[model samples]
Target: MIVIPTRLKSTRFENKILCDIFGVPMFIATANVAKKVDDVLIAVDDEKVLKIANDYGFKAVMTKTTHESGTDRINEAVSKMGLKDSEVIINLQADEPFFEGLNLTKFKEFAMEQILNQDAFMASAYKYIEKSEADNPNLVKVVVDENSTALYFSRSKIPFDREPYNDYKGHIGIYAYSVKTLMEFCDFSQSKLEKTEKLEQLRALSNGKKISMLKMESKSIGIDTKEDLEKALKVFKKVNND
Candidate 1:
């Protein structure tokens, strides 16, 4: 099951989820993409969001607004859904209106492969960062181990190129987890590095969870502000034309 965690309050943009890009609310766009998967639900914290989900004829559940992060809200939703411990759960971000269906299908395929190997506790997507994005702190960078496991995630550029570094990968917000692992993550408290870096995935890494990252060729524009929304609108129109 894929769970989209959405909140009405956004520090960067007021009522970001409610903001329309191409005549539909941002979260609705996200939900529309996610509904293509086998099972999808919007885990919302506000009545307004729930109403919006129902209006769109999508499955949704109201959760407590006190969740500290999207992962927390997803965990609560999973419990309410009575998912089995072995069920797979994908965490899709509500702001990602531009996520393509092919990319999502690839993500699910990668996750199923990892589950068959019985080594990955969680999985997420990453793509090679363009040189232009290296300086943008909003584009989080990651350092990976030889096995393609994440070593660290930071808002700052990693592996400081003392020697003209030309390559790095940017972390995407999507995540997939086994139901058992998701419950375990909820039981554990946030780690120190997670708090300092303000990156929630660090908590899983610090706790010794192995997260496999699938390299994707496609990239989606995340809507965080009015400027980003405009850019996404343009992309949406272009895709619609195509």
Candidate 2:
């Protein structure tokens, strides 16, 4: 199941999930893309969000207003919904409207393989990005081992490019984990690296947990700031016109 954790307010863009994108709210657009891959659920934090989700004919569950992260929010929603421990849950960010259906399909397959092989309890994807683009803090950078297992994720540029390199691996905003692992991850104390980098995936890595990384091409735009939304809008228009 694909679960979108929807928080009403954001530090950078307030009520961003409700922001209009391509004639629909951003969260709704994200759900539409997710629906193409699997069952979609919106784990919302506000009554306004819940009402909007219902009006749009989407399944939603209310979570706590004070949850620190989307991961925590979805954990509550999944627990309330009584999902089985073995069920895989994809945690797609509500702000990532352009996370394509094809990428999600590939992500699901990769996640299943990782889970079955016991390679990692957590899974995510990354794509090769230009070194120049990697300088943008909003576009997170990830380094992986020979097996495509993630070593570290950071908002700052990684590896320092001791030698000139053309590309870096940029982390995508989506994640997959079984209900059991999700619950266990949330139980872990918020790690120093996680708090410092503001990247939740670090908590798992800091706790000596493995996160399998899938390398794939994706056109998803994660709308963190208003500037990101503007960029996405331009890309959206261009894609449609083409």
Candidate 3:
């Protein structure tokens, strides 16, 4: 099952989830995309968001507004939905409405494979970061070991590029976790690196959790600032027309 954590408050773009995109709220567009998964729910804090979700006939639940991150919101929703401990929960962001169907399908496949191997508790998508985006702090970079397990996540350019870079990987916001791992993650307090870098995934890493990165052919645009929303709206319109 997939859970979308949406909130009305955003420092970069106020009420971004409620903003209109081709006549529908931006959050609805994201929900619509996520509903393509096998099972999904929208976890929201605002009553207005809940009403809008119900009006659109999507499965949604109201959660506490004090949740620190989307992961926390998803944990609450998973418990409310009465999902099994072994159930796979994909954490899809409300700001990302352009996720490709094939990528999602592939992600599920890889997650199942990892579970079968008894190797990983969580998985996320990673894309080859373009040179242009390498220096962008907003585009978080990740380094992986030889086995492809994540070593560290950094906001600055990784590998230093001292001898010129050949390849780089950027973390995508999407994540999949087993209910057991999700509960454990929520129980763990924020770590030093997590607070310093402001990256929630780092908390797991700090605790020696292995996060498998599934390299995908496609990437989704997450709406952060007004410009990002504009670009995402254009992409959404094109996708809707198709």
Candidate 4:
């Protein structure tokens, strides 16, 4: 199941999810696009968001307003829905409307393949980072071993080099895992690295949960700040015209 965990109190762009994109609410646009591949649900924190979601003709679930992270909200939604242990859950951000979802189709295959050989239960994707974005803390960086197993995820530039850096991978904000593993990860305490970097994925990595990383090409336009939203609007117009 594809789930979007959204809330109203956005730090950078207040109520960004409700902002219009392509003539509709950003979250609704995201869900409508995702529905082309499969059914989608929105886990929201407030009645306003829930009402908006339902008005958009999408399934909505109300979660605790006190949740620390979106993942925690997703975990609670999964439990509330009573999903099967083997059911796959994808957390696609409500603000990302252009994510190339074809890549996600392979997550189950890759995860199962890794499970047979390693301890991988969670999976995510990354893309090559631009030179300018390499030093940007807003874009998370990831370094992986030869096997494509994530070595670390950080807000700072990773794999610091003495010479000119050659390659950098920016972490995407989407994740895929079974309902069971999703809950397990939520129960784990925030790790030291997680606290320092403020990245929840580190909590799973710190607790010995293997996260398999997939290389992806297509990406979504993320709306974080007003400038980003403006860029997204232009992109939306271009996409619509195309």
Candidate 5:
């Protein structure tokens, strides 16, 4: 199952999800793409969003407006749904209308394998980013161990290079977990690193949970501002033409 946590307002782009993407609303477009791979449910914060989801014929549930993160919102939705503990779930961001170069089918398979193996409580993808682009604080960076297990995630540039190199792995916001792990993760209190970095995944790491990372060729463009929306529109047009 793929769950999208839809918050109506945004600090950078107010009600951005309602913004148009090639004639479709951003959140609805995200749902449309995700439904191609698996079941989709929008965990919405506002009733206005819920009505839109219902009108679009997508499954949706109302969540609290007080949740701090998308992950927390989806966890609440899943808990209310009564899915089995082992159900594989991908926390797909509503902001990501499309993920160029990623095969959602393969990603789902990887999530299933990792969750069933129980080696890691969570799974996520990272893509190689240029050294020049790595300095942008909006783009989160991740460092992984030899085994592809996440070592750390941060907004600032990592591994200060003595000699400049370009192997920076930009962290994709999407995350995968089994129902049990999702529940366990949300139960944890926000960690010091999480609050400091404003990243939710740090809570998992600080609590000794392992996150298996997969390297993929994806340029995930999550729309955070009006500029991002314009960028995404151009990218979407180029992708379709290609």
Candidate 6:
């Protein structure tokens, strides 16, 4: 199952999830994209979000507005649904309106491959970033070990670029996890690194959760500011017009 953790409040953009994209709300647009993957649900904290989900005929679960992170909300939402400990779940961030549903469909295959290995219950993805994206603080970067395991995630550029090297990968904010690990994630306090980098994936790495990351081609833009929304609007128009 794929669950989208949604909230009405956004520090960067006011009511971002509820913001209109073309015609639909950003979160509602994202839900339509994700619904093509498999069983999808919106894990919402606000009554307005729940109502929007219902209006769109999408399944939703009410979670606490107090959840510090989407992962926490996900744990609560799934727990309410009585999912099995071993159930696989994919988390699709609600602000990602431009994300391709096809990428998520393919993600399930890649994530399933990693989960079968037993060495990892969490899996994510990233793609090589252009130099222009390196300076963008909103684009989270990642460094992976030789085994494709996540070493670190940061809003700042990673690896320090000590030499003639390049090849930075920006993390796509999607994650797949086993229900057991999902529940365990809620019990963890925010790690020092997580607080410093402002990247929640650090909490998992700091706690020794092996996260396997698959490298894929980059696509879509995460809406952090109005500029990103405008770019997405143009992209949406071109795609639809084509």
TM-score each candidate. 0.95, 0.98, 0.94, 0.93, 0.96, 0.96
> In candidate 1, residue 118 scores what lDDT?
66
Candidate closer to the true structure by TM-score (higher is better), 1 or 4 = 1
Better of 3 and 6 by TM-score: 6
lDDT tens digits by residue: candidate 3, 1-242: 87889988976788998888677888887777777766769999999889999999988999999987899989998898787788888888888777787787888888867754658867887889787887888788898888888998998989788797868898888888888899999999989998898888998999989899898777588787888888877876787789
User: What is the alpha-carbon lDDT for the whole of candidate 5?
Assistant: 0.89
Q: Decide which is better by lDDT, 2 or 5.
A: 2
Shift in Å, residue 63, candidate 4: 0.3
The model with the greatest lDDT is 2
Better of 2 and 6 by TM-score: 2
Candidate 6 lDDT over residue span 33-130, tens digit each: 88888888899988888998999999999998887778888888999898888788999999998887778878888887777666685899998988
Alpha-carbon shift of residue 198 in model 5 (angstroms) = 0.9
Clashing pairs in model 5, backbone N/Cα/C closer than 3 A: none
| Candidate 4: RMSD to truth | 1.9
lDDT of 1 by residue, 121-230 (tens): 88988889876787777778888888889888998888788898777899888898888888888888999988887778998999998899988887598876788888
Off by over 4 Å in 3: 235-242
**Candidate 4 weakest lDDT stretch, 10 residues:** 109-118
Which residue pairs of candidate 4 clash?
Answer: none
Ranking by lDDT: 2, 5, 6, 1, 3, 4
Which residue segments of model 1 deviate by more than 4 Å? none
Clashing pairs in 2: none
lDDT of 4 at 151: 88
lDDT by residue (tens digit), candidate 2, 1-242: 99999988888799999889989999999999999899989999889889989998999999998988899999999999888888999999999998888889999998877876677979999999987898899889999999998999999999788999766999998899999999999999899999999999999999999999988898878999999999999998899999
Candidate 6 Cα misplacement greater than 4 A, ranges: none
